[model samples]
Target: MSYIKAGTDVNGNDVKLHYIDQGQGSPIVLIHGWPATYEMWEYQLAELPKHGHRVIAYTRRGFGNSSKTWEGNDYDTLADDLNAVLETLDLQDVTLVGFSMGGGEVARYMSRYNGARVSKVAFVSAVTPFLLKTDDNPDGADKSVFDDMVDGIRKDRFDFLQSFGKKFFGVGVISHPVSQATLDWMQSICQLASPRATEQCVYAFAATDFRQDLATLKVPTLVIHGSSDDTVPAKVSGERMTQYVSHAQFVEYSGAPHGLFVTEKERLNRDILAFAAGGTVEGTADRY
Candidate 1:
């Protein structure tokens, strides 16, 4: 793992993103979500290379050990940072995978960067299409919901994260398949993120609309969500995402929670490998 200067953001703040590249063959750049770093994809990092696929995971600005810039927590800059990573490496025919807030980065990358050098995209327990409720977005969440989240995070980031982590993994909210140690592990990683960045990102992912970005995605796409997701519910996110992307395959992990990547590692890994190999994906997936 190395930290490379990814160039300054729009605000002229110099930012260095931490990233690691491994294995050979086509590249797969995995983007993580709010309050998380590239390390969030540790499982993929360890396994994908063994299967003949290069795995590249990077920490976004303000997350993990990356430079914590005060400005630019929205999707536009986040997406730009991701594009910069792939461009720096001159990687092509790449499969971009984004989880949670990273899903917004994937959409923005396609629309903002024109999907240059990108062949495929994937969303795992993502937040996409439109998350906030407005006059036009009737199915989205209430304004107060997001407002309260930002308030709570600003008030006490650590405490708020402690509560958010439960819903994130669906511990008591649903039947989560992880031990307390696993939950603690996730929290430790989250604690590494800058509190301000974490707070601002709640607004970025919750309020930003990616409907147009979804339309811009022309390549093959994969959507995976836990049926019992509580953080970003399947009902609001992946379920509707299947309708947005042009050529997309959807996977639902029954009884799995928001952190299905941990709760259902074996199954999730199999699906990821199959998709990366360009194998025929079932048009639709029944619950796991």
Candidate 2:
């Protein structure tokens, strides 16, 4: 129930960000994905602490219990908000982990603040490097893909989320990675977010390019993505991250999907714990 003041909104009102700060040794700050609050890290929050690590997860402004401001949805402001949390808490030698859209914040923070207070970073099923396809960025997804997302959200947010949730966890005809109840719960959490922020963030993650930010990473890095991630494909995001961050350990989860955080929670937790402890990460050789 802890909260941090993340600057002020356009109307000069204070914008408070709700965060969960727990556990006691080496800090690990988690930034959640799009349309999700800090609650998404339910398993990690419970597990990481028992292993002697402090886990801090916060709800991005306009999501969950945080302030619902109409602006500051872009990466620059989002990174600043992240900076506020790190500086306010005065955390040091930290492990910053970003999931899905949260990865963009991790990448931007490195470039924006030069990796202050961070020693290690992990990108789990993140949307990083870049996402929109241009003539030069051929591997990027088509602009139309993002366009449709915006249109869908604007048209019918709940309906779009319901459909998107299925694809997020790789829920197919025969393959049910997550139960229907889990999907329903996720949708309920997503529905708590401000509709304006939800729609605006779609453009932020889709259009913002993090290639330069990725190059600025100097700390130990880990890139983990699913091989069958249809949301943010491995080829365009995680696979390409290794090119910029030459020393990063890349691990591809075979047959996993975008929501690997939930679908592969145990494996994901183990890998993150190993990396945080400066130990050898499992499946580093299984790069796809």
Model 2, residue 145: distance off in Å is 0.8
Query: Which runs of model 2 end up more than 4 angstroms from their true locations?
Result: 286-288
Q: Considering summed lDDT, which 10 consecutive residues are worst modelled in model 2?
A: 279-288
> Compared to the true structure, candidate 2 yields what TM-score?
0.98
Q: Give all TM-scores, in the order shown.
A: 0.94, 0.98
Cα lDDT computed for each candidate against the true fold: 0.85, 0.93
**What is the RMSD, in Å, between candidate 1 and the native fold over all Cα?**
2.3
Q: Candidate 2: RMSD over Cα atoms?
A: 1.3
- lDDT, candidate 1, 81-113, per-residue tens: 888898888999998989889999999999999
Which lDDT value does model 2 have at 42?
Answer: 90
